[model samples]
Target: MSLARIYRGGLPSSKFIDVALGQGARLLIRRSSDRGIRGLMGRQSERRWIRMGHNLIQAGKAKRGRGMHTSGETDMQGKAKRGRGWAIALSVLAAAAVLGFGGYHLWLHRDVRVYVNGVPVDIRYRSSFGEICDEAGVVPEAGDLYSIAGNLIATGGGGPFTVSLDGVELSEAQLDAVEVEGGESFTVRDGDDAVEDSEVVERITAPRLVPAERLAAVTYVSQWGANGIDRVRVGAVSGEEILEEVVQEPRDCVLASVNPVPSDGRRLVCLTFDDGPSPYTAQVLQILEEKGACATFFVLGSNVGPWSDAIQGLEAAGCEVMSHTMNHRNHYATTSDETYRETADAFAALRDCAGVYTSVIRPPYGNWNEHCWISSRGTMSASVIWNVDSRDWELPGADAIVENCTSGIENGDIILLHDGGGDRSQDIEALPRIIDILREQGFELVTLSELMDADDRIPDEAARQYAPMPEDCAWPAQIAE
Candidate 1:
C-alpha cells in the first residue's frame, strides 16, 4: 500500500511503535529515506537504525550469489544489485512494522480522550463508547447521542435524524459493530434539515366568538373566546419557524361567560331619546353614526318642522322616530285635552315628515296616568318607559350620566336619554360612552320596537305598556302627573 494510505489511518508508524510495538519496531521507520520519518526519530533511534541497516546489507550479500556469477555480465549485475538489494530489505521491514503494530496494546496508562459537541473528556481507555460512557457515568436515553469509534448509535425523533460514522449512517445493529477501544470522537445533534429548508412558520391564531345569527333578535354573549398560540397548534418546536402555521391540531376550547342563547340570537338594548330632533339631535346622531349604534328618537310635535332635517336623518339612518308629547305637557287630568293634542300631533308630525309610523310613545315625565293612558290608549300602541336612566335632564356631569346609564344594565334594557329638553351637551357627551360601555358589556343597542319585540316577547309584556287608572282612580294619577 502507498505511504499516503498508511498516513490516512491517522496512527503514525513511529508513534504506534512507541505506544504498542516498543523500541524494537521504531528502527524500521528511522531507516526510511523520507525526510519526515527521519526527522521524527531521536538520536538513539537513528543509531539503532544504522545497526539494522548493516545487518540487512550482510543478509542481502549472502543471497546475491546463490547461483554462479559470470565474469562477462559481472559489472551490469553489480549495478543492478547495488540499487535493488537495500530497497527489497527496507520494503519488507516497513510492511512488517505496519501489520505488527496495527493491533498493538497501549499499556502506558494515560488519559484517553472522548469528545462531545467539541468539548474534550479525559478518561481511561474503555472497550466501547457505551463502556466509556458507563465508566464516565454517561448513559444515553432515547434522544441522547452515542458513538462507538466513529459510528453513531441509532437515535431519531421519529423522523429523519441521521447519525453517521465517517459519513455512513448506521442503524443500532451497525452501531454495535463499532468499538470505542481508545480515543475516538462522536457527535450528538438534533437534525432538522427538512424543517429548516422550508420557510413555513407555525403559529396559533386567537380564539374569537363567532356569534351566529338568530331569529329571536335577543341573546347575550355566552362565550368570550380567548387568543391561542398558533393556527393549528400552540407552542413551536425546535427547527420550526413558527411564522404562520403548524401541522398538529390544537384542542378547541369552549369558554362561556354569559347565559346561553340561540346560536344566531342578538341581544336588544334601546337607546331612547325622550324629547329630541333638536339642534343637539345632530350631535347625537353623529355620535350614533361614529359608534354604529341605532336609537329611538321620541320626536315632539313642537320641534318637528324646525328640526325636520335632523329628525328625518335619524329615521333614514335606521332609528325609531316616535312621539313625545307636543309642547311638553304633563300627563294630568287638567291638561288631558292639551296632552292628547300634543301626543297626537307629535305622532302625526313624525309620520308626515319621515314617512314612518311608530306604535310607541314616551309620555312626558315617563308618566302613564289615568289622563294620559286614557287619552293615548287606542292611538298609542305602547308607552315606552326606561330601565336605564342617564338622568342627563338633571344636568348631572357627563360622567355621572354615563355611570347611571351603564350601571345595572340588562338584556332588553331601555336606556333613556334626551337630544332635546334643555342644554343637551351632557347628553351628547354621555351618549357615545353609554353605547361603548353597553357594547363592551356585550349589550346590542337597538330601537325601542326592536327591544320590545326581542326574544319573541309580546310588545305589551316587553314594554312599559299603557297605564290603567290608579287604584283610587285619581290619587296615583295626581302624584304621577
Candidate 2:
C-alpha cells in the first residue's frame, strides 16, 4: 500500500505498525505506555530510537521497489528485507508508545491556577469553578468581581459568575460553566456593578394607648394614628434601610373606661378648688395644664355671670366645674327651703352662664348637714369635703400653702384650696409646686368624680343619672337614711 494510504485519516504511524506486528505487539505497546516507558529510557536509548525511525522509513522505500526484483530473487530478498523491516518497526513502535504515555501522564496531573484578590491559589483537579474555589480555599462574595475566564465556575453561593474573556462579556451559560485554565487570574474587589434595586414596603403600625380611670365608656384620641415605611435593597447581599423622614411619632391616646383596678394599685387623690372663676383661676388652669394634672373647680354661682369665660376655661382645661352654692350661702344657717333654693339656683346659674353641668357639689364651708341633705337630696352625687386644707384664703405665703397642701396628704384625700374670695396669688404659686410634689409622691391628682368612682362611693342609682340632676328627675322631700 502507498505510504499516503497507510497514514490516511491522521491515525498515528505506530497504530499501523502495531497492526502489522499483530495483537501481541499492540498489547505490549499499551502496557509500556501505561507504566511510563520514558522513566526507564536514557539519552543512549533515545539515540537508538532515532536510528530505528530512519530504518523504518528506508524499509517503506524498499517495499515500494519490491515488484522490480526477479521472482526467485524476490523470494530470497523479500524474506531478509521483511525480517529487517519488522525489527525497525518494532523499535520505532516502542519509542512512540513511551513518548505518548509520558505526554498523557503529564496532561492528567496538569495544574489549574488563578489569582484571588492578588493571592495565588493552585488547584489540582479539573473540577467546576465553584468546586475549584473550595479546593483552593477561595470564596468570592456578592460584591466581589470575577473576570478574564470565558467559562467561570460559580462560587459557593452558586451564581452566574460575572465573567469576560479578552474584555468581551460572556453569556450566562458560559459564566456558570465549570472551566478553569492554568495561569488565569481573577480579582475579588469592591465592584460598582453589583446589581442594586429597591422596593417600597408599607407596614401597619398599632396606635399607642394610655388608660385613664373613668366611669364613661369612651375613648379619647390624644394623638392621631399613622402607618410606617421601610426601604429594602436587593442585590448579591440583602439589607434593610430605615429611612429618616418627617415621620409623625406615634402618641398615646387616653382611653377612659372602668378598669378592673389601677395597674400600679395606688390610691388616687382629688384636688378641689372652691369658689373659683376668680382672677387667679386662669393662672391655676395654666399651672394644671403645664403639670399635666386635672382637678375639680367648685365655682360660685354669683361669679359665673362675671367670669363666664373663666368657668368655661376650667371645663376646657379638663377640670371638673361644679357648684359651691349661690352667693356662698352657709348651708348650716339656711333653712331647709332656703338651702334647696341655694343649691338648685347655683346649678341653674352654672348651666345658664357657662353651659357647665356636674353632679358634685362643695357645700359652703362644707356644711352639708341633715337640713342641706334633705333639701338637696337628688341635686348632688356627693358632698366633696376636703380633709387636706392649704388654708390659702388666710393669705398664707406660697411656701406655707405648698407645705400645708402636701403634708398629711394620704391616698383618697381631698385637697382644698380656694381660687377666689380673696387674693389667690399664693394659691396659684403653690399649685404647680404641690402638683410636682404629689407626683413625686406617686399620687395621681384626679377629679372628684374619678376619685369617688375609684372608691366605689357613687351609688349605682346616682351613677345611672347624668350630671347636673337631669331635668326630668324629681327631688324627694324626705331625708335619706
Candidate 3:
C-alpha cells in the first residue's frame, strides 16, 4: 500500500481493479459499469459512470485491504481506495444474484402443478382440467365415474363396476369451461369407472326418403330429424328391442347407418338374397343375367355342400357371395362360442368351396353384440340388412313378395329375399318379375359390394338394440323423447 507503488501503474482505481480481476484476459469481463464501454445504454452517460466507478473502487478497496503506511497521508489514501473497490464489488455481486434468481423463475418455474390420479405432474401453462387429464394419459372409459371441477357426474355402475375420480374430473370440454391457472393443484380421481354417466346430448333420427312426383330422377332427405343416443352402462341388458347380453355401447344403434350407403356417387340398388342358393338358384342367376344385372347371396354354411357350384357360378356371373351363418339362429339366444362357430363355419365353407373369403356376415338373424363383433373380429366386415323385406319365406306368395320389394325400391335400397330355404320357388317365380319391374323403373341392379362400398351394414330396425338409460343415471333428456 505504498504511495510510490500505488502511482506505479498510473492506472485509475477502476482500471486497476479491472486489471487485478483479469478483465483484459477475460476473467471477470461481465459488468459494464467499470469498463467505460457500454455507455449507459444509448447515451454517453458512461463519462459520469466512469468517474463514479473510480471513486467507488478506491473507497471499496480501502475498506477491505491494508493501506500503505509509508506516510500518514498515503495510508489514508490507500484505505479510501480499498474501501471503495470492496463496496463496488459487493454491489455488482448482489445485483447479479438478484437478476439470476429472477431469470431462473421466468424460465424454468412457469408450469402449473397438478396431481392426476395422485401423482404430481407439471403442465407448462394454464390448462383446463380435461386437457391435463389427457396430458396425464387418463382418458375416461365408458362406465368410469366422472366429475367436472367439483361436480360429480353420477352413473350407476355401482361398487364392482365403478370408477372414482378422487376429486376433480375435468373432461376436455369441462376443462375448457373453467379457468385453471398455473401453479394451482387439483385432484383427479381413480378414473377407472365402469359405468359412464355421460349426458346423452343429442338425438340423431333415422333417415327417410320422399318420392317427388314432380321430380322423377332426383331425391332429397325429407325430414331432418335428430337422433337421441344416450351413453348407458349396463353389464348385461336384455329387452325385446336390444337382447344383447353384452358390454360396451354400440357406436350408434344401427338405426342410422352411413347417411348415404352408396357414397360411390352412383345410381345403384342392391339385390341381396339371404338363406339362399336354393333348388332354384339357376333361375335367380338367369333372371339377373337376363336383366344384365348383379346380385349378392348370403348363403348358409350348411347349404354350401349341396350348392357349391351355384355359389361359384354366382361369383362367376359377376355377383358377390356373403355369409348367412351355419344356421340362422337368434343371436341373443346363442353363446359367444356358438356365434363364433356360426360365423367361422360359414366363412370356412365359402372359402373352401368357392376359393374366396368375404368379411360380410349377416349375423344369422341380423343380430349383434360386443361379443358377436369380438368373436368375428377379423372375419366379418359388415352385417347386411335389408331396407326392403320381401319376406318370401313367409310364403305370402309371389305377388306379395314382388309388391314388398318393388313398392319402395330406391337408391341404395337392399331388397331382401330367400333363394334357399323352403319353397324358394316362390322367390324363383317372383325373381324375373321383380327384375323386370325394377328395370322398367330405371333401377340398376348391382351386388352388395357394387351397390355400396364398405361395411354399409345395419341392424334390423326390429332388433331395437339400444341401451336403456341407467337406473341411477342423472343425465338430462337428450331429445325430448
Best-fitting candidate, scored by TM-score: 2
lDDT of 3 by residue, 1-481 (tens): 3333433432345554443333222322244333322322213333333454566666655643554437778866665665554556646744654464445445443677666656776776556566777678875443423332222345533333222234544555554565445545555433345432333222322212112233211111122222234333232221112222323222221122342355555557778887877877888888888878888888898889888988889889888888889888887888767877888888888789877577566665556643455454234545556677798878998999889989967677778887777778888888888888888887778776554442234223111111122233222212121
Q: Candidate 2 lDDT, tens digit per residue, 319-396?
A: 888888888887778787788778788888988888987655677776764346556645654455667778888887
Per-model TM-score versus the true fold: 0.40, 0.43, 0.42
Off by over 4 Å in 3: 1-256, 259-261, 454-481
Error of 1 at 425 (Å): 1.1
Candidate closer to the true structure by TM-score (higher is better), 2 or 3: 2
Global lDDT of each candidate = 0.56, 0.61, 0.57
**Residue-wise C-alpha lDDT for candidate 1, range 263-364, written one tens digit per residue:** 346766778887777778888888888988898887787787787777778878887777776767667644566666777777777667756566457677
lDDT score for candidate 3 against the true structure? 0.57
Which residue ranges in model 2 land beyond 4 Å of their true spot? 1-264, 460-474
Candidate 2 clashing pairs, residues 3+ apart or interchain: 129-153
| Candidate 2 local lDDT, residue 156 | 33
